[model samples]
Every structure is written in C-alpha cells, then in structure tokens.
Target chain A: MKVELTLFGQLADIAGRTKFQLQDIPDTDTLQKKIHEMYPEMANMSYSIAVNKKTIHENTVFEGDANVALLPPFSGG
Target chain B: MSERKIKNIFSQGPIPATFIAESIQKHSSQTAIGGHSIFLGQVRADETEQGKVKAIDYTAFEEMALEKMHQIREEIFAKYPITCMHVHHSLGQVQAGEICLFVFSSSAHRKAAIDSCNEIVERIKAELPIWGKEIMENDSHQWKVNK
Candidate 1:
C-alpha cells in the first residue's frame, strides 16, 4: 500500500520536500529509519509523528493507506 | 449558545488594525458583557548572523489546527464564564512590526475576560501545529522557535 507522507516545519527543509508517497512502509519506526537513511541530518533532530492528523507516541502499524506527517517543534502564537 | 463549531481563524497576511476595531464594535450590542480583553501578537525583527529578519512566512497544517483549536475553545469556555471569544492568526508573509495574531474575550466581569484571553493565547502558542520561517534581508531564512 502507498501512504502520503508529509513533513512540516524544519523537517520539510531537512527532507528537501514536503509531501510525497511512501510504498511498503510498514510502520512509523520503519518510516523514520528510511528518512534517516535518505537524509542523515534528520537523525539527530527532534520531531513527532502523526498519522491521519493525530500524533502518535509509539510505532504504529499501518492497516491501510494512511496520511502520515512528520512534525518538528511548533512555534506558533 | 455554547459553540462546538470549528472557527476559521487564519487571515491571509497581516491583520489590519481596522479589523480589530470592527470586531470590538460588533460586540457593542451585547451590553451584558461588562469587560473585554484583547491580545495582539506582532512580528518582531530579529538580527541574525546571516542577516536581519524583514518578515515572517507563516504556515500551518490547517486541517489539524482547526480541530485542535476547537477543543481549546471548548475548554476555555467551560472553565471561564466568558460570553464571547474570537481569535485570528495570520498566514502567508507578514512584515516585521505587523500584527499577526489577535485574540479577544468578553465576560460579565473583568477577571474571566482577562484570564481566559491569556490562557487562550498561551494554548495557541503551545498546542497549534503552526510554523514561521523568518525571511531575512539577505534572502536567507530561519525557523522560529517559541520562547
């Protein structure tokens, strides 16, 4: 299955892109690992993962096509 | 009536001072509200090693932020005896010294209006998934971190 993965804040700058599709990524942990492999600089940065607009704490298996987002520290007023 | 409605608070760019005045005037008919509290956030120019910041480009995960804001609004209303509340934030580019966020709260007494307005501003900063990129005069950019 393919999932649309979006990166926000500094994560997007690090990734060099914002939203794209991921194929065959099983869970959040795998997704993070793949991103780190592609952009090693992202490995040291702090971020949060959200699936379908809800933030997730632990690795969550994808049951179907999902919308995933990588969020860096928010700075809003 | 209490609200569960999701309010769209994002404005295109800088929030004009006239819009804020009009908002206050709209509430004049609701004379039951004895006190009104207002908060405005302005973009400040900061000098960085690269250059001086001239403006800010603000963006947000809009679909999620509105949902989060709805929850915050509900909680604020439940905790404070506020009769009315309104919040507005800016998207796109806002120049330095321009107003970017506006929050207003009204109540029968001064305390609830003041307290709730403060709380709402705090929550918006802490909880919303918005980001600001400081655009420098040298054409470089830096991400903003809330202090």
Candidate 2:
C-alpha cells in the first residue's frame, strides 16, 4: 500500500522536503518501521504520528488514503 | 445574544488587547460572582546550550491545534462556572520579549477565574501540536520546548 507521509520542524529540514510517499508498507506499524529503517537518524529523536490529522498510538491501522504526519514535540504557548 | 469571538493566530505580531477586553465583556453576568484573571506568555531572548536565542519562529499543526483548543474550551467550561474563556497563540516568527500567548478567564469570583486561566495555559502547553524554532545569533536554530 502507498501512504502519504509528512515531515515537520527539524525533521523537515533534515529530510530536505516536507512531504513524500512511501510504497510497499503494509500498515501503519510497518510504515513506521520502514521510516526508521530509511532514516536511522530519526531513531534518536522523539516523535508522534497522526493519521489523517488525529494522533494515534501504535497498532493503529492505516487506510491507504490516510495522510500521516510525523511531529516533533511542540513548543508553543 | 452573547457574542463568541475567535481571533487570528499569528507567530510574529502583537497580541491584540481586544481579545481580553472582549472576553470580559462577553462573560459579564449580573448574578454571578465577579472577577477575571489573565495570563500572558511572552518570548524572551536568552542563551541556550546550543546558542543565543535571537527570536522564535512559531508554527502549528493548525488542524490539530484548533481541534485541541476547542476541546480545551469545552473542558474548562464544563469543569468550572466560567463566564467565558479565550486563548490566542501566535503562528510565524516572534521576536524576543514579544507576546506569544494570551489567556483570559472570567467567573463569578476571582478564584475560579485565576485557577481556570492557569489550567488552560498548562493544558495548551502540554497538548497542542505547536512548534517553536529558537533562532540563534549565528543564524542557526533549534526547537524550543518546556522540559
């Protein structure tokens, strides 16, 4: 399945783009696993996942059309 | 009818005093106890382990931020006899010592207003998906957050 992935903040800067597509991932967990595999640097940073703008924990299923975003810890007032 | 107001969220501009004044005016209750308290958070230039923070560039996951803000408003209203509450946060780049957030709450008595304001601010800091980049004097930057 194909999923749309978005990177924000420092991740966006390091990745050099805000949005990208990941192919061949079967589900959300696998997608996350693939991301960590592709970007080993991400393993050291804390982040959160939002599937179609709603935050979810591990084991959540990802429909192919969902818009997934990777977010770093927020620092706003 | 009472008015409900939502103001613009920005990152590099002044927080309007009207948001606070209007919240007070809207929440006025003749029979309820009367007092209001506000908490304003301002950004300051400071030295960090990485470097000197010259300014902050603020950004938000807007869809999620608004959703969280609405939930917070509802929770505060349900938890306290608050006449009204308002929260405003900035979006772009805020210079050092500039206002970034303004929270206002009004209730029958001073205690509820003060307590509600504090709770709301804490909730916002803890829950919202907003990010800030601390720009250094050397043209480098790092993300800023409360530890």
Candidate 3:
C-alpha cells in the first residue's frame, strides 16, 4: 500500500521537507524502520506515529492508502 | 452538560490584548457567570547556548489538536460546573513578552472557574500536538519542550 508521511517539529527539520510518500509500508513498525533507515539521526530521537490523525502506541496495519504523521514531543502553550 | 460544537482555538500571530478585552466585554451579558478565570501564556526570552530567544514560531497538527482539544473540553465540562469556556492559541511567530495562549473559564463561583481554568492550561501544555521553534537573535533556532 502507498502512504503519505508528514513530519512535524524537529522531524521536519531533519527531513528537510515536511511531507513525502512511501510504498510497501504495510504497518507502523515497518514504517518506523524505513524512516530510521532513511534518516539515521532520527533513530535516537523519540517521537510518536499518528495514523489518520490518531496517535497509536502499538503497531497498526494500514488497510489501503493512509496518511501518516511523525510527531515529535508537543511544545504548545 | 450541554451540547457544544468542536471549536477551533487557533489564531494567526499573537493574540492581541484588545481582542481579549472584547471577549470579556461580550461575556458581560451572561449574568449567570459570577466569576471568570483567565490564563495568558507569554513568550519568554530564554537564554540558550546559541543566543537569547527573540521570538517563537508556533505550529501544530491542526486536525489532531482540534480533535484532542474537543475531547478535553468535553471532559472538563463534565467534571466542572463551568458556565462557559473560551480558548485562543497563537499560530505563526510571536515576539518575546507577547501573549501566545489565552484560556478563559467562567462559572457560578470562583472555585470552579479558577480550578477548571488551571486544569485546562496544564492539559493543553501536555496533550496538544503543537510545537514552538525558538528563534534566536542570530537566526539560530531551538525547539521548546514544556516542563
């Protein structure tokens, strides 16, 4: 399945762009591994994955097309 | 508890003092509200190794923040006997010493208003999916993490 990934906060800085598309990433676990492989610096950074705007703690499988977000620790007032 | 719609709490740039005043003025018609509590978050010029922060650039995952905020709002209303509540948080850049966040809670008595207002602020700081990039004088930057 194809999915779009949007990075937020410091992750956006590391990626040099905010959004990208990935193919064959069926689950959040594989997505994390692929992301770290692409941006090794992010391996040590702590962040949460949000699928379709909902933050998920456990690995979630994507049925079809999905919108994924890499959210760093929130700092809003 | 009454039925309430999910409201957008974001405003571009700093929240002006006049706007805040107008909000309070509008609420005067609601005589049932005996007390109102307000919380204003200011951008402090924090010192870092790069330089002193001159401003903050705020951004958020809007869809998620609104959804999460709606849940928090509903929970607060159920827990407290508040008459009304208003929240406004700044987007984009806000200079140091300017107001970036405003939360107002009103109730029949002071205790409910004050307590709910304080609790909302804490939850907002910890729960919302927003970020602030500290802009330094020399064009350097750092991300702000709430304590």
What DockQ, on C-alphas, does every prediction get? 0.87, 0.78, 0.95
> Which window of ten consecutive residues has the lowest lDDT sum in model 3 chain A?
A46-55
Q: lDDT by residue for model 1 over B84-134, one digit each (tens)?
A: 899999999999999999999999999999999999999999989999999
Chain A TM per candidate, in order of listing:
0.94, 0.88, 0.98
Provide the clashing-pair count of each candidate structure. Answer: 0, 7, 0
RMSD of 2: 3.3
Best-fitting candidate, scored by lDDT:
3
Ranking by TM-score: 3, 1, 2
lDDT of 1 by residue, A18-65 (tens): 989989999889988988998899999988888999999999999899
A1-77 per-residue lDDT for model 2 (tens digits): 77889888887877888899987767778887888898888878999999888888876776566788899987878
Clashing pairs in 1: none
Model 2, runs deviating above 4 Å: B1-12, B16-33
Under CAPRI classification, how is model 1 graded? high
lDDT, each prediction: 0.92, 0.80, 0.96
* TM-score of chain A, model number 2: 0.88
Which candidate, 2 or 3, would have the higher lDDT against the true structure? 3
Worst 10 contiguous positions by lDDT, candidate 2 chain A: A58-67
Q: Estimate each model's TM-score.
A: 0.96, 0.87, 0.98
- Candidate 3 residue lDDT tens string, B14-99: 99999999999999899999999999999999999989999999999998999999999999999999998999999999999999
Error in Å for residue B138 of model 2: 2.0
Off by over 4 Å in 3: none
Clashing residue pairs, candidate 3? none
